[model samples]
Target: MDENCDYIFKGYTPNFTLQEDDIRAIQALYGGKPSKSFSSPLSNSIETYQAVSKQMAPSVKSSNKNSALCLDPQFDAIITIDDDTYIFKGI
Candidate 1:
């Protein structure tokens, strides 16, 4: 896929917790962390970002079956900033 063609979604939801398992799953398919680098606007409150950074573990359980985040087994996925999701064509 063309790098520039990738879509960008926005927002931040502490509840859309992404964990190591998900990262590992992606790594198994595409190798480490894809091609993207972590580059958020640092100008925001450092404390705010640091707080959110700490929330990636202890995944939000799937028990919330009604959770709005749709999971498509066909494509690899990433939790967008909001607890919503982005399904991608994984390699």
Candidate 2:
């Protein structure tokens, strides 16, 4: 057997938004605080944020295919919408 074959492969799908429990589980496994920085440029602009949210809102409400957590830099807030409920947190 090749030495590299000793490593186990794990597959993950991309572009999937993590839920609160998912985030907590990852943190518990990693044993660290989550990063404070936003990963997407969409977080820096309100118009873009609103636009994306508008696009994602229907899909999120209608199905489990897409979910989003967006940051509003101007207000220093993180927003997540699930079905009919919306959650906002300050960073």
Best by lDDT: 1
**Candidate 1 lDDT, tens digit per residue, 1-91?**
6744676544345677657797788889888753777666764666565566556434676667543333322334455657876665433
Runs in model 1 lying further than 4 Å from the true structure: 1-16, 34-91
lDDT tens readout by residue for model 2, 1-91? 7843674333344786878887889988886664685466655586776767676564435333323334232332234556555444333
Backbone Cα, N, C clashes tallied per candidate: 0, 0
Worst 10 residues of 2 by lDDT: 68-77
Say which candidate scores most in TM-score: 1
Model 1 scores worst on lDDT over the 10 consecutive residues at: 66-75
lDDT, model 1, position 75 = 37
